[model samples]
Target: MRASLIALVLALSAVPAHALPPPCSGGQVYEDRNGNATRDAGEPGLPGIKVSNGIDIAVTDAQGEYGLDYVDGRTLFIIKPAGYDLAVRPDGLPARWRNLQYHAGPALKHGGIPQRQPDCTHFGLRPQAAAATKGELDVLLFADSQTSSVKDVDYYWRDIVQPLVGKHGAVLGLTLGDVTNDDLSLYPEILRTTMSLQAPWLFIPGNHDLDFDAAGDEDSLRTFRHHLGPDTFAWEEEAATFIGLDDVIYQPGQTPSYFGGLREDQFAFLQAYLPTVRKDRLLVIGVHIPVYEPGARGFRPADRERLFAMLEDFPHVLLLSGHTHTQRHWYHDASTGWHGLQPLHEYNVGAACGAYWSGVKDAEGIPDTTMADGTPNGYARLRVRAGGAYALSWHPARGTDDSGIGLHVPRVLRKGAYPAWGVFANVYMGDAETRVEYRIDGGEWKPMKRVEQPDPRLLLENMRDDTADALRGYDRSPEAEASPHLWRGALPTDLPEGEHAVEVRAFDRWRGERSARTSYRLQVGEP
Candidate 1:
C-alpha cells in the first residue's frame, strides 16, 4: 500500500501545479521541414536545444521535449542552437521566445506590452542553407542609436545605416542599447530601419530605454521586450555564442533610475546558461553599460566580481558595451577579480549616436557628432574566427580618408622655432600599447609618443564653438576630453618654406596598418 501511495505521490508531483498563476509548461523544439512554422504531422523534433524561462534553463530531451517550472509573468525563449535560426516574427525579429503572461499590468507611460499573446509555446527553427560552419563570421556592432527626435532618426539613417544598407558582409548585427532616447514610440521605425540591413540584428535595453513608470527592474523594459524581443537573449553562431544581457538595474525612486549591475534573475540566467557555452569557441557578451566603473562604482563591484567568477572558465571571452559616448578598450586582470589565464577584454564601444547627436553639422547635413575623444560617430565590426579569436575595427560614419586614424596637423608653423606643436593622431580604435609612428616629408618613420591628451582636431572645434558669435550648428561639438588612444609627434619647424607632408601610421594589432596624412607649412615668423 505504501509503495502504491508513493507512486501516486510521484505521479501527483509530476503533474504541473495548475493552481499557480503560471503553470508548469512543456514544449518541443522541432525542425520545420516544410517551413510552415507549424508542427505538422511527420515533423521530426530536434534534441538538445536549450529553452529558458529568463532565469532557469532546460535542455530538450531526445524527442525535443522540454519543461520549465512556473514563473509569474515570465517568457520562455530558446537558446538558438548553431546552424539553425528561429523564424522571423511579423514584427521582423527572430521569434525565439513566447510570452506566457497574456495580460498587461497598470497602464504605463510608454504603453507597456499589449494584452494579447502573439506566439505559441512551441518554437520552430529552420536550418540555414549557407550557415557559417567554418567558424568564421563578421558581426556589425552598433550602440547608442539614441534618436531623440524624428530629425535625429533621419540623421541616424542617413549617417549610420544608409551607407551600409547592402555594403556589409556581416552574418549578424548587434546594437548594444539605447535604441531610442527615452521615446519608446519610435521602436517600430527603429526596428524597420535596422532590419533593412538584411542581417539577424539583436538588441539589449539601455538605461535610456526604460519605462520609468514601472515599479522596479523587472518591469523596466516591458515596452522594450514587447518590441525588441527579449532584452536578454542568446544567439548561436558557427564560431561563437552571442549573449545579450540587460544589466541595467532600475532603482524606483533613485536619482538615477538605473545603474549598471546584474539582478538575481540575470545572475540566475548566466549561471544556467554559461555552462552550456562551448569553451573552444569565442563568447561575445553584449551589455549597455561597461563593466568597469570609471567613477564611484558606475557599475556595482559585487556584481562584476560575481560575473567575472562565472566567466573565468572560458578561455576566450569578449565584453562589448556602449553607454559611454566614447570608445575605449579595458583589460581586466587580478585587480578586477578576473584570474583567467589571459586578461579579459572589454571593448566599451563608442556611441552610434555620438554625443547624443550634439555636434555641428557636416557637409552631408549629418551631425558631426564626434565623441569627446574625437572619434567620429560610427559603428564597429567584429570579426570572429574559430578557436576563440576575434579582431575589431571601427568605421567612421563619414570618412574623408580610408585610414582609421584621424590626424591633426597645424596649418602653418614658423621656421626655426621650437617644434613644441606636434601632430596629434586620434586612433579611434587604438590602445595604449598600439605602435604609432609618424613621418614628415616622406622621411624615415619616427615613433610617436602615446599621450592622454585631448585630440587637437576636437580642440580646434571646441575653440570654434567657444568663439562663435552664435550657435554654430544644431548644437556645438562636445568639449575636448583626454583621449587614451592619441599619439603625438613633434613636426620639424626648421623644414624650409614649403608645405611638408605629414603621415601618421598606426600598426593595429588586428586589422593591420592604417595611415593618415596631413601637411604643415613653414612660414617666416609667428603671428
Candidate 2:
C-alpha cells in the first residue's frame, strides 16, 4: 500500500504550514482530478464538501480550504461528497482522514496513534469513477469480527474472510461493530486482515472496543481513533448517504461498564450534518447498538425516540446495528416514534465471530460458529439502487448458496403417529411481508405460519450439549432464542409407508426467493 516517492511527498506537502481560520484549524481539501492521489498544480479546490470532527460540521470553501479546532483527540474525516471519491490504500481502505491525537494519555498496549503536527491536517479527494456515481451501489456488511487472540484472528481470516475474498460485487465494506473482544491492542492486525478484501472498510465502535483505563466515556475511543478513523462520521455514494455513529458509552470504575446511547456531541453532529443530505437520497445509519432496545440493558429509549424525530423529514432511511450476536429484524412504527409511511427497518445482523467462535470444530479445523438463533455466522450484502430502493441478503460463512434459508424436520415418523410433528423453516431474512409455504409429495403448496419462536435446529443442538454424557466439543453452542424469521407447518403423519419429499419455499419482500428440500420416511409399524 505504498505510493511512489514523489507522489507521497506531494501528498504530504499539501497541508498548509500555518493554521487557517479559527474554526478551520485543519488543512485543505484539494481536487485530485487526475486520480494520481497527489495534489497537482492545476487541480482546483472543491467547494461545499462537508467535513467533521465528530461534533462540529464544516464545509470546504471555494478554495477547498476547511478546518476545525482540535477537539478532544477525535478523528477528522471528510464526508465523501457526491461525484468525488477519497484516495484509497492499495487494499482499498479509504485514506480519507488524519488521526489527530493531541494528548498521548496511557501508553497503548496494542495500536499506535499518530500525533498531530503544530498546524492542521490536510485531506485530498479524487473524482469518482463514472460507474460508481451512476445511481447503483453494493456494500458488504460485517458485524462483530471480535477477535480476542492471535488464534481467533487466524480463524477469522482463514474461515470467514478468505472465502469472501473476491466473491461478491461489493465496492466497500462496513463492519457494524465489536471489531475486537475487549482487546484494543488487536486493532492493527485485525485492520490488516480486513484490508485484504480489497474494499474500503468503514468501522463503527462497539462496546468491546473500549479503553477500560479511560476516565470517562469521552476518552474511551482514544485507542480506536489511533487505528481506524473517527468512531462517528458520514460519507456519500451515489444516491445514498451512509452515517456511522459510536453509541457505546463507557463508565469507568473497578468493574468497567457501558451502555447504548449516543453522546451529546454525536447528536449535535447529526443534527448539523443530516440537513445537508438531500431528502431524496437513501439515508443509511450504522450503529454498534440497535436503536430499538433488545433487552433491559439495550439502547436507551429516549435517545432512540429523539433520533427518530430527527429522521422524520427523510422518507428513505434504514438502520443497521450489531451487538446481540443474534440475527433479528425490528420495525419502529408510530409506537416507536417513527411516523413515516412505512416502519423504520432496523436489521440487527449476526456476528462474524459466530457465537464467539464456539461449538465443535469442523473438518477444516474451523469452528461451527452458527448463531444461537440458528442463523449462520456470516456477513450481509446490501444492494442500493436509485430512488431509495434497497435489498439485503445474509451470506453464511460456510455451506449452502445465497438462499439464506435453514430447515429443521424429523428424518422419520410413524405412519399413524400419536404425537404431532411439524416442519420449520428458518428464513434468515424473512419479514412480515415475506410469503412462506411448504409442500409434501408434490402436493399443493400450503402456507406456513410466521411464528416468533426458537429455531428447532438450534434448540436440538443446545439439547445435545445440555444432555451430553460428559464434556462435548470445545464449547457448547449458544442457547436458542426466539427468532423473527422462523416459519412452521404441521407435517402429515398418516401418509403411506414410503419416503416422501418435503419442499419449503419463501418469497421475501425484497424481491428474493429461496427454496430448500428434505425427506421424511414414514414406517408402517411403530418402533
Candidate 3:
C-alpha cells in the first residue's frame, strides 16, 4: 500500500504548493498554453469560465476577464469549466480558489485561514482532452474518516484504505467531513494518505473538524482552509456537478454547539450557480450532516426548506452526507419541502472510521471497526453514467466478498432442542425494500424476516470484551444498536447430529443477488 501510494503521487501530472492562497483581488482564467504557471503573452484568456465569491458567480467574458462583487468571510473560487483542468498547487489542494481573509475575524485559536491578504488572484487553467470530460464517473467517497489519534490515522490506512488501494478506479474523490476527530494538525498526514489516490479531491468541514477556540461560526474553519482548499465549492464533470458545502453551523453557548444547516453565503452561491448548471446533469451535494429530516434535532428546519426550494427545479439530484456512523437512504417528499416530481434521494453514507475505530484487532493488527448499524469500516463507490444515472455499492474493509452480508450462527446447537436457534444476517446495505431468504442443505429457500436488532456478531464481540481477563484491545466494540439492515431467520435444529450448511441470499435492488454461507453443528449429549 505504501509503495503504491508513493507511486500515485509521483504519477500525478502536477502537484500544488503546501500553503493556502492569499486574496485574489482579480484574475483571468487564461489558457496556460506555454505550460508555465504564469500567463505568457501568447496564452489567451478563456471565455465562459465561471468564478464565484462563495455567493455570486461571474462568467469570463469574450476576453476571458471575470469579476464578482465581494462578499466578506467567503473564499473566491473559479468553477472548473469543461475542457480545462485546474492548475493545482504542490500540496495537492485544488488551486481554483483564493483565500479571502477578513483580518477582522476573532483571533482564531487554530489561526483562521492565514491573513496574508495579498493582491493578485489570477489563476491558470490547463487544457484538458475533450474525451476526458465526457465519460462516466467512478467516484470514491469517504464521507467520514474522523481519525482522533495517530493510532486512529494508522488504522484508517490499514483498516479502511489499504485494501482498496489500486482496485477502485475512481476518477474523482471527496471526503464529506470530520476529516479528523479534533486534531486539526493531522491534516497534513491525512492529505498525504489521500494523495496515494492520485486524484483531485475535495473536503468539507464537520463539527468535529472545528476550531473550538474560534468565537464565531464563520471563523471555525480557519484551520481547515489553511490546509484543504475551500469548505464550500463545486467541481463539474460531464455527467454531474459535485458540490460540497460546510453545512455545520456552530453556536457558542448552545446545548449542541453545532447544527446541520447551511450559511447565507452558501445559499447565495447556490442560487447564482444553479442556473448555470445544466438541468440535464446530475447534481450531487455533499455535506457533513444529514439534511434536516422531520424530528431530527439540531438540523435547522428553515435552512433545509430553503435548500429544498433551491433544488426543487432539478430532477436528478442526490444528497450525500456523513456524521452518523450508521448508513441510510431517505427519499425526501413534500413533507420536508421537497415538491420535486420525484422524491429526493439522500444517502446518509456509513462512516469510514466505523464508530470511532473501536472494536478488537483483526489478524492484520487493524481494528474490526464495524459500525453499530453493522456497516463495515470502509468507503463507498459511486458510479455515474452519461445520462444522469448512478448506482452505489458499499465495499467492506475486511476482505472476503461474501455477498455484502455478514451472518452470525451459533457454532453448535443441542440436537433437536425445540428447534429454537436462528440465524442473523447483517446485510450491510440492505434497506426496507430488500428481500432476503435462507435455505439449509439445499432445501427450499425460506423467507427471512426483516428485523431491527443489534447485530449478534458485534454482540458476541462485546461479550468477549466484557469477559476478557485483560484488555481485548484499545477499546471494546461500540454497544450494538438496532440495525436497520439486519434480517433474521429461525434455523431448524431438528436435523441429525452432524454439520449442516446454511445459505442466505439477498436481492439488492441495484447490485442484484448476493449470497453468504455458514454452517451449524447439532451435537448430542453423552449419556
Candidate 4:
C-alpha cells in the first residue's frame, strides 16, 4: 500500500507542465483481480457502485463506465460497494477517489478555482478474499491523536501506536478526528505511525486539522485533502455500512471558529446515498463532533434531526464521534428527536492523546496521558457480528487485562462514623443497560446507583494538580468533567478496623461480567 501511494505521487508529480487534461467528465470502475492495479482481459466490470461529484450522484453501468457533467472544484469519488474493499495507501487511507485537480505541486492554488482534470478518470477495486468476507469484523477506533510536535508524535508512536503493531485482527480502523494538532504537515508522520497497525484506516477532519487561512468552510480542509482523501465518503465491511461525514464548519476570519454542522452538500450526498443501502445492514456513521449538543457546544439540532429522520427506518444503527477528548455513551430517542423505535446509540470514544498528551512522563518516557474523564489514553475495538449485532470495548494503552472497571475508594475511613465515603467505579464502555454491583469483604452484593458525575479518580488528580506549588508535569491535565459511565455507592461505616476488600462487578449488554478489586482500611476514630 505504501509503495502504491509513493508511485502515484511520483506519477502525478511527473505530469508535463503544459499538458493538462480536459475537464474530468466521467470514469470507469473495473475489477483488478490479477492484483496488478489495472484493467486486464477477462476481468469483469462492477455495477451498482455509486459515484458522486458533490452535488450530483451517478451509478456505473454494466460495462463499469460512469459519466457526469464536469463540475470544476467539486471532488469526485466512488461510494465503495458492499462486500468489496478499495486499495489503500500504506497509512490505511482508502484510495477510492480522484481529486480532479489538474495541478500537483506546491504552487497549486490554495483556495482558488481548482484546476480541471482530463475526462474518463477511472477507479479500480480489488476483490476481497472469501475468508476476508466473514460476517464478523473487528474495527479499531482511535480518536484525537492530537500530536502538536515531533516529540508528541514520538510519544504517540511509543505509547499508543506501538502496542498494536503486530496484532492485525482488526479488519478496519478509524480515527474520529484531530489526527494532528494544527500542523497539517505532520499528517505523513501520523499516517506512517498508523500504518503499523496494518488495517485500512478512515479519518474524519477535526477543527485542529483545518487550514484556518482558507477563505471559507468549503476550502478550510485543502491541506487535509492534500494529505488525506475526500472529507466525506462511505464504504462497507461485512454486515455494516460505514459513512464518514465531515461535520466541522470553519468560519474563516481573524478569530475563526469551527462549528459542528453538515453542509448542504453533505446532506444532499446522504439523501442520495442512504436509500441504496440494504435495510438489514447496520448503519455506522462516523463524525468528529457529537450530533446532540454537549454543554454550550455541539452539532446543530436541525442537522441532527434530519440525520435521525434519514435513519428512522433502519433498526440497527450506531454513531461514533470523538472531539471532546472524553469517553461517553449517549442514547437519543423521541425526546431527542429520534424517530426510530430503538434509540440511536452514540459512542463518544476516548482519545489516543489523552489530555493532549499532558501529565508526567512514565518510565518509557511516554506521557501518562489519561483522559480527563479517567479513561486511559487508548483505542477502542468494535466487533460487529454478521447479523448487525455489535459490541464495543476499550483497551488501555498498557494493559493486558480486559477489566473495564476503574474503582476508587479511600485508603482509610473512620469506623463507626457517618457513611461519608463512597465507592466509585468508572465503567469505561458502559451504557444504561450495564449493571454495576459492589460487595465488601465477600458480603452480599448490592447494586450501585449510576451517577452522571466526574470520575472520583480524575477529580483527585485534578485536585493534586491544583494544589501544587508549581506545575507538576509536562502540563496540568484538563479539569474533570462529568463522566457518563460513573457509578457510586456508599461504603458501609460499621466494618471492623482492618483492611477490607471492595469488589466491583460490571455487566455490559454485550460483553459479559468483569470484576475489579481494591482494598481499603477502616481505621479507629481520630477526629
What overall lDDT, based on C-alpha atoms, would model 2 receive against the true structure?
A: 0.83
Residue 150 CA displacement from its true place in model 2, Å: 1.8
Q: TM-scores across all candidates?
A: 0.93, 0.91, 0.91, 0.91
Best by the TM-score measure = 1
- Per lDDT, the best of the predicted structures is 1
3 or 4, greater by TM-score: 3
Clashes of each: 0, 3, 9, 0
Residue-level lDDT of model 4, residues 257-348, one tens digit each, is 76788999988988888888877767899999888654434787888888888989988999999998888888998877898888799999
lDDT string for model 3 (388-439, tens) is 7898888877565737899999999888687677999988878888899999
Model 3 shows how many backbone clashes?
9
Candidate 1 runs further than 4 Å off:
1-24, 117-120
* TM-score for candidate 4, residues paired by index: 0.91
Q: Which structure is stronger by lDDT: 1 or 2?
A: 1
Query: Between which residue pairs do clashes occur in model 1?
Result: none
Residue 526 error, candidate 1, Å: 8.3
Model 3 segments beyond 4 Å from truth?
1-24, 34-36, 71-73, 102-105, 292-297, 525-527
lDDT of 3 at 189: 90
Task: For candidate 4, give the lDDT of residue 173.
Answer: 89
